[model samples]
Target chain A: MTIKQIERLRKGAITLLMLAISILFLLPFLWMLSASFKIEADVFTYPIQWIPAKWHIIENYKEVWIGKFPFYKYYWNTVKVTVLTTVTSAFVSALAAYGFSKINFAASKYLFIIVLATYMIPHQAILVPQFILYRQIGFFDSHLGLILLSSFSVLGTFMLRQFFMGVHNEYIESAKIDGAGHWRIFWQIAFPLVRPAVATYAILRFIWTWNDYQNPLIFLRTDKLYTIQLAMQKFTTINGEFYSLIMAAAVSAILPLLIVFIIGQKSVIEGIALGGVKG
Target chain B: MQKLETAAEAPKAKHISKRSSLQKKETIAGLLFVGPMLIGVTVLTFIPIIATFLLSLADWNFIAGFKDIKWVGFDNYERLLQDDGFMKSLKNNAYFLLTVPIYLAISMLLAILIDKHVYMKSYFKVAYFMPYISSIVAVAIVWQVLFHPSAGPVNQLLISFGIDNPPKWIADPKYALPSLMMISIWISIGFNLIVYIAGLQSIPKDLYEAADIDGANAWHKFKSITFPQLSSTSFFLLVTGIISTFKIFDLIAILTKGGPISSTSMLVWHLYDTAFVNLKIGYASSMAVILFACVMLITVLQWLGQKKWVNY
Candidate 1:
């Protein structure tokens, strides 16, 4: 073969290999999706059915969504907690980020370092104490509790601070000269300039709170107040025998985030790339 | 004379007031903006840490009021030495650290391949990253279905290959931890892959072109250029992946419940089981303290090591 022809052939070969491997890496998701639409008997049946023979998409989804357990309540609970936490956390973290990045105060520097240091301490370390504190404050088991607990994150503050720093000090100073106060300056100038970063952190927070298992597992007690993670835990442990139901429930849990992942693929992916920090 | 003097002093007085007001506003604004976070940090993070440390030194089961507490300094720490479960959990966490290399290697390979050849990168990125973004509860449940003992596809595939009596994955005492390790690695690959891709793309193209002109092989080019360039990213992934995987809890909680004899019981899971499930709050607090110290120590070591070893 000619050298140029050899290069073409190698390129083709690499493309083919990448395609096959991508599919293989995607097998778990494919399996989950396929299983989500399958009946109970066909779910684990031999030869690995890639597509269900008798598609039970509606039946399976309906069963998981509103059937005996009615997962919608937990879904709403999750939605409420996620939205509240995301907005509040974004707002609160942005405020802190602005203070740290824009304000010239000695304590801001020391305080930023403390917040950054707190990021290193795993949530589990303080988990027990927080649990006790939450109980004491009557914040446990309520969606409000979840909202309050996750309302601000050091990671969010830190990530947004990096963006806040990118905003020109000129803008804030100019705004200040116009008699804009601190709140007005942060609100009108700094916050909007870093809106995209704030949104990124908020979107990430939404996903994180939605996916959080540890907090709800500990704090949430009553089933009525359980988040999706807590609800899914209960659902799966009791109903794991029904692969179709569990898979369907799994589908319900992931479909929204998957949609978000697909639609906001660039932002979400870029968000991680920005800091090398995963939500 | 009084009017002339007052007129001159008015501007100076206004300038001084403006400067003072600006300074005052700065301090107050700084305090105002960072106030919520300061409170959160103190209330949620700082206090809890002190409370956890103090709780570790005490004997409390979390059932009684403040009066029920019994101070027992160093006793919990002493018990941790003899605690076989805690040791096993640490061992499991150490075992879990093995995923870091696997994650790094796979991420590097896939990242390089996609960076070089893949025309449609987002498809592969989202496909691999779906599990990472999805709820662990959802992932666990789906994995549970996949790891089902008798009829699961994994066993069915193995059975087709004629290896009968395939170990029941999550249920098998021997394979449970390893199986969970596999899942954690799978979940980790997506994030690391994206990070690795970002790292690879940051490398200047001329380095590769020069290598091509020199007739250097792919392996050599990667070793000298790509690998060295990726050291910082790899170091980051290494530190983070190890720390995160060591805290593996949700998957184990949903899939195996630390399984057939605590095989999959990790440090975080052990802490959960001790404090929450078993209600040994003080003991679990000690475990928490140990876990915190270990994470901090490792992070400090890695940060120090980066100065010497990592490129950036």
Candidate 2:
């Protein structure tokens, strides 16, 4: 064969290999999505029936939504916590980032390093003390406590700081010459310029807070306060023997996050890329 | 305003104005903006960490009053040194660290292969990343079912292939930790792949063209060009991956609860069990401090290692 033909053949082989690899990666999710709609008896059928003999999608979803498991309550709780944490974290981190980036002060560098050092402390190390302290303050088992704890992310602070540093000094100087105070300059100039970064951090913080299980598990004890993950765990116990129902509940719990990710993936990927670069 | 003018008259307004109100105002705004975070770090994080250190030195149980507290300076650390469970956890964590690098390499390979193919990139990317986005609780539960010895799909598949007896995965002390490792590697490959793909895409096409012009084969080009260019991404993945894997707890909690015979208990999982289940808060705090020190030491060593190889 000619060189060009050989090259085409090689490319075809590589594509075929990639296609096989992709199929392997995708198989479990396909099985999960398919099994969610299957009858309980059909869940473990041999050779793995790709399609369910019977579709129980409606029944499964109905049970998941309004059954003994208060799945909807969990969804709402998760939504509230996630939204509050994301907005507050983004706002606070951005404001702080502007301060660190533009404002000159004594011991600023030392203070920034101290903030960065906080990132290195493992969550496990702080759990006992934090739990004890929160209990003493009567904040334990309260949504406000969880929200407050989630809002103070060192990663968000560092990410926003990097973005704020990238902002041009000229804009702040121009705003300064106009007799605009520091807050005015921050709001009018820096905020708009770094809007993309702010949005990126917000979406990421939302996903992280939404997916976090340990904090919610430890802090939120009441059934009413359960988040989606905690709710999913509760679903398992309530319907311990019903594999199909549990799968359905799991699907419902993940669906919102999947939707959010699909919608905001571009910014999320960009933010991760930027974060990796800084690291 | 007249009083301010009179005060300014006593001292030269120029001298007073030498330090720009702009500077003072900016300083105040900076403090105001960072104020909440500073307070949080001091009260919620920094103070708690110091408190943990102190708590580790005392034996205090919540059920018992503070009046009954006992000072156990170095006793917890001594027990930790002699405790078989703690030693087992440390060994398991080391095994976890060893296994993680292999998984990360596999992920990098998968990412590079997918990146080389021009089509179906996003399809593979999303598929690989699905596990990363899924809850660890869900992942662990699903894997637990899959690994069931009697009727689970994995064993059933093995039986269909003519194997007589499949190992009871999470139940058997021998197979439990390895089983956990396998599932972790499977779930984590996707996340690292995403990072690798991002790194691969950033490389200029012209570098490959130059290699091709020099009569370099695919393997040679990959070794000299692709791998070198990807070193920074690789280092980032290695450090973060090790850190994350070492601190793993949720999967162990959901699946094995530190196990059939404590085989699957990682350091963090052990720490959790000690603190929450056993209520050995002081001992658990010491374990946590040890874990923290281990992580810090590893990170520093990795940084030093990177100085020899990592370009930037």
Candidate 3:
């Protein structure tokens, strides 16, 4: 065979391999989408239906959204908590990062280390006491409690601190020369410069809060206050036999994140990558 | 605004005083800036941690409040040594950690393949990474449907291949933990792939060119150049993965509920069940302490061990 023919053969093999792996990775998502639209009996039919023969799209989605349990309530609860948590976390962490990086005060280094040391404390280890404290402080059984618990993250503070540290001290000095207060400096100069980093952490915080189950499970007791994850758990347990309904609910639960991934694809990859390598 | 005029009107030596006051103002501003976090970390994290440790020492049904608490000293810790539930959960965590190596291999392989001047790079990346960003609850539900006993696609396929019987998976005692591990592996490989791709991209091209000039084969190039360069990323993944695997709760909660005779239970699951369901506050706190200890010990050991070979 000619050299060109051999090269073409190698390329063909690689392309085929790539396609196979991509399809394999995408199979679960495909199954979820296809199964959501399939009829109850057709949902699990053999040969793995790539496409549903009998589309039950309206019926399945309608039952999930406004049926007996009203899944959209949980969806709205999640949206409320997610938005509040992400905004609060990003803002709080940014302030803390600015303080830790730029300001020099008594025991600043030790205090920062002490904050980071909390990362070593397992979430469950703190849960027992936090649960008690929540009861005492009137934070139990409400979205407010879940929101408070989710809003403060040590990892987000640490991640954003790295970006803040990259900002030159000369800017702080020049701003001071202009009689700009520290708050002004933080609001105007440092934040905008690291907006991408802040945005990265914010997007991640949004996803984490939206997907968080443990906090909602432990802190929330009211059926009306449940996040989508908590609701999904209850829904699946109660409706295990209804594959069509469960898959439709799964599709609804994942739709937001899928849209998020599509829109912020590059930033999400970069955020996790940066977060990983830094660790 | 008037402060500047007053400073100018005063002695020139007072210039130093103005600057000093500004520094003082900054100190207060710094405290004020970090005040919310300080209060948060203390109330939610720092105090809870200390409180958890103290609570572990006492016997309390958690109904009568702190006033009715009884100190049991080391009794809870003693019970952990004898608890079969605790031991089984620990073993299950070890089994779950088995996913780490499989994840590393599959993610690494895909990274190498896609790294080789592949076309439609972003398209391939999005497809592979879709699962990592997906909510675990949704993933579990779909997998539950797929793994259904009689009518599910997975069992149906196995039957068509002429196997008389397949494991009940997620419901069977022997297959429960392993089944969860499989779902974990499926959900996790996307993250590993993204991290590995980033690691591969950071490796310089000249390393490959230098290998080519020496007539080195792909295997040789990979061993010498690729492996060392990616070692740091792999080490990071290893330590973090170990820490995270110790805290595996969401999947167990959604998929198995630490059930079918507690086959899929991990430390977090056991702790949750103990504290919330059974109301064994003291006992569960002890378990949480152990969980924290294991995570810390593994992290410290990894940090110290990385001194051996993780080249920056």
TM-score: model 2 vs. ground truth: 0.94
Cα error of candidate 1 at position B225, Å: 0.5
- TM-score of each candidate structure, all chains considered together: 0.96, 0.94, 0.95
DockQ, structure candidate 1 = 0.76
Ranking by TM-score: 1, 3, 2
Candidate with better TM-score, 1 vs 2 = 1
Candidate maximizing TM-score: 1
Q: Looking at candidate 1, what is the lDDT of residue B43?
A: 94
**Clashing pairs in model 1?**
none
Q: Which candidate would rank higher by lDDT, 1 or 2? A: 1
What is the Å distance of residue B244 in model 2 from its true position?
A: 0.9
Model 2 stretches with alpha carbons more than 4 Å out: A1-8, A277-279, B1-13, B16-21
- What is the C-alpha DockQ of each candidate? 0.76, 0.55, 0.64
lDDT of 1 by residue, A1-279 (tens): 999788777777887777887776678778888988998888877888888899999998898889888899989988888888888898889989889999998687788888889888988999999999999999888888878888868999889999999999898889877988888888877788888887777777888988998888888898888888888778877885787887788778888897877777788888998788875
Off by over 4 Å in 3: A1-9, A277-279, B1-19
Among all windows of ten consecutive residues in candidate 1 chain B, which has the lowest summed lDDT?
A: B115-124
Flag the better candidate by lDDT, 2 or 3. 3
- State each candidate's clash count: 0, 0, 0
